[model samples]
Target: MFYDVFVFLVIILTLLILSGLVSASEVSLFSLPSETLERFSKSKIRTHKLIAKILEHPQRLLITILISNNFINVGIALLSTLSALRLSYAININPEYAVSISIIVVTVLVLLF
Candidate 1:
């Protein structure tokens, strides 16, 4: 039970970090000025050209980022719930209380970090 909970925590933390990185990328990429993009498009560097090419279809990038964020958030929620259930059963406590606590705690955590 302890190992299962630890694994769940590790996964949840990773997913949270991934979600944050994805969100940061969305902000940073979309916030770039037109001049910067233009420079990137004309740059000799392969990486810059690739970035410009990918950014050419802003709609697709936005959709992809949004989908990734959604999946990460859902995974965190699912793991939290499962861990909470495991905890409730292990301690012979009311499952609803454990689930409710876990939900509140996880939500706060996701919001805070």
Candidate 2:
């Protein structure tokens, strides 16, 4: 009942955070100039070196990011719909209004994140 809705909300929030991080990483990774990438390549840090190596093929990186974001977005939509349905059933309200509320809340969360 209420517990299921709460679980959905929690999952939705987590996905929103993940979506934001994925979006940020895409921007940050692509915005790096060649010089910075070169520096990273030469750095002693393994993580930096790996980043430089991965950035060599921009197409693959971009595709992976887009795919992940798309999946997260889909998950968010599915969960939102489920939670909205549960909420409507629990409160005995019109499903349309519950759906509208879910849409608004999801939009705001996406924008904020």
Summing lDDT over every window of 10 consecutive residues in candidate 1, give the lowest-scoring window: 104-113
Clashing pairs in 1: none
Q: Give the TM-score of candidate 1.
A: 0.93
Per-candidate TM-scores read 0.93, 0.93
Off by over 4 Å in 1: none
Q: Which stretches of candidate 2 lie over 4 Å from their true place?
A: none
Candidate 1 structure quality by residue, lDDT tens digits, 1-113? 97998899999999999988999999989998999999999999998898899899999999999999888988999999999999899989999999999999989977764
C-alpha positional error of residue 101 in candidate 1 after TM-score superposition, expressed in Å: 1.3
